[model samples]
Target chain A: MDREFRNNKPDMFTVELFDATSDLAESLAHSEVIMRFTNSNQVLINDQDAQRLVQEANELHQKLYAKDASRDFMRENFPRYRELQNQIASNPVLQEQSEAQEMAINFLREVNQEISQLLGIDFGSLTRRPDATC
Target chain B: MDNLTLNEPEVASKSRVMEVARRFTETLAETAQYRALEETYQAFRQDGEAQAAYTALQTKQQTLRMVTMLNAVGEEDRLALKQLEDQFYGLKSVQNYIQAQETLISMCQEIGDILSDAVGLNFGLACRVGGCCG
Candidate 1:
């Protein structure tokens, strides 16, 4: 039996589903939390001082985790990495971005909860790709 | 930057976000994939033979749980389990149910990808219960 329901051309129902998904995405993107997140992200990106600190921390993080890095090397660089992380965390732009991101995530979770409630399944878990690490 | 607050009047209210989410869920319910999944599941539930086969398989598996875990199942027990599995899977209702589920999952994965792209986050991963760390 040919059981495949999908084809190269989607049916009207599939088109409607996609459109609704787009509308939801648009609403979420325009929501205050997401808007704040976007704005804060922009601010963080435009801040040269924050970017430099982030870059420096990232480079140190890579070195610390490198296969050839000795225990002594790790010990020497770990404190500096922590200090750089502290500086980045203290930056107002970065702080706002972090908060905004957290808010956006919470909002999305709430939305997912609503969807799951109506559908009688965990939408996120069902939709998650098989290869996804998480 | 001043202390960021989510209480601003300019932000989209939670009610509006929920409304859009409801719309998305309603649209998803209308999709062919979802409809097929629902119908097949109902059919599978109503299929006495398929349900009996599944119950038999599960009972056999439970009976052999300890032996199976230790890889010490006797040949007769193993063959019995295999036969039960085959019987359960051979049912048309079971096959239809599985196919419908796969199609629905594929549709959901596409939607997840779209939402992830639009929201600048892995929608499925973020909304997952317990999340990546958990």
Candidate 2:
């Protein structure tokens, strides 16, 4: 926007950049890894047993950490919490979802690395949200 | 099922993703903000005065790192550091470089948001070098 540093055809450049960004996003979203991740996630979310287990675990977690909960109560419920987590971990659907998500994330990181190498800058770090803690 | 190892299909998909990412980076490099950032950075790098001021500030900071961490910096040392910072920021080239970087970062943030929304994940966060703990 500053005239001193303005490039020719700024508007056109912006449009092209946005279009390219969208294309990249679409390609990533449609990639086999990402699609597999999405499908597994959907399957996990749609499973009644999985949803119930997750909800129960969340409720128990809240109770364990509640202000009024006694230390003894937390100690007693901790094992149950671990059991619920193990159940979730052992579920084939959840396992598949986790594996797929990891693959998708790795694929995205590889793409980001390619872009960063080409641009000579950490694209992910540069684009990170200002308020992001991690 | 080992997510760490990419299968043949995943490898092919990753290549496609990188191709799109390359196009996105090329478009981004042509943007006005990117051009301004590059130009201003080059100017700053070539400005001897600005470079000297930056080096001075960095050296002072390094020298005072322990004292500053311990909250034992004397008035003289603090003032000296402040003066170096002021001098560094007062340069036209430095100011231009900072402005250009901020503008480019803002544009990149918007692009990151678009990617995150389309892919149902935080693109920048996911691509970060380390996970949340880092």
Candidate 3:
């Protein structure tokens, strides 16, 4: 028999199950924490200064890993890199984005933990990719 | 920033969202694949022969740790390890257990993808199920 027939022999069961999932999804979409995170992240992503700072950081990181990079060059640019890092860290939008993102992640973690506790197994672990290290 | 719409009328309470999560978990447990996986896992756990094969392989690996780490495992030891692995894999019970597990994992991954799409974060990644490496 096909999987659907096995899992959903009773149509009402499938409907109720999906309805619950959709309800949870809808609530998640309307969450204040998630909304704040999404909006703040978008603002940070759109900010020119923030974008430049990120690009500068990436370039500095790449240079640090470059085969031909000299110790002197690193020593020379390290201070500037630190300054840029501090600037990024000090940006209010970035900071709020970070906080909101953490809150959103925590929210999901709490939800998953609740489900796992109820189900007697780690739901997230069960849902992980087959090749995942865990 | 706009006040969150979550605080508006028709908002879902935390308890309600958790209820939905519980329902979803119950639905997942009722699936044929998940039931099969649980049954096969129980069988694997109860199978004395399979357990012995697994324990023996683990013991052999532990005893050969030094040789294996040094990449100097003797031909005889290598052959012995391969034989043990083959013997373990050749068990019908072990094979069924493994297949059942794979099927269940696949189904879970699909459901996780749906949850991730709805929640705007990779569900497994957000849960940190295995580790942060992925």
Q: How much is the lDDT of residue A26 in candidate 2?
A: 72
Taking the tens digit of each residue's C-alpha lDDT, what string does model 3 give over A24-121? 66666556666666678789878988878889998998997799999999999989889988988998877887788778778878889998998787
Q: Output the lDDT of residue A25, model 3.
A: 66
Model 3 ranges off by over 4 Å: A1-20, A130-134, B1-11
Lowest lDDT sum, 10 consecutive residues, model 3 chain B, at B1-10
Looking at model 2, residue A29 earns an lDDT score of 71
Best-fitting candidate, scored by DockQ: 2
DockQ of each: 0.39, 0.40, 0.38
Q: What is the lDDT of candidate 3?
A: 0.74
Return the TM-score for each candidate structure.
0.80, 0.84, 0.81
Ranking by TM-score: 2, 3, 1
As for TM-score, the candidate ahead, 1 or 3, is 3
- Candidate 3 versus the native: TM-score? 0.81
Task: For candidate 2, list the clashing residue pairs, or say none.
Answer: none
Better of 1 and 3 by DockQ: 1
Error of 3 at A8 (Å): 17
List, residue by residue over B10-127, the lDDT tens digit for candidate 2.
3236677788899889988888888899999999999999999999999999999999999999999999999999999999999999999888888788777777765667888889
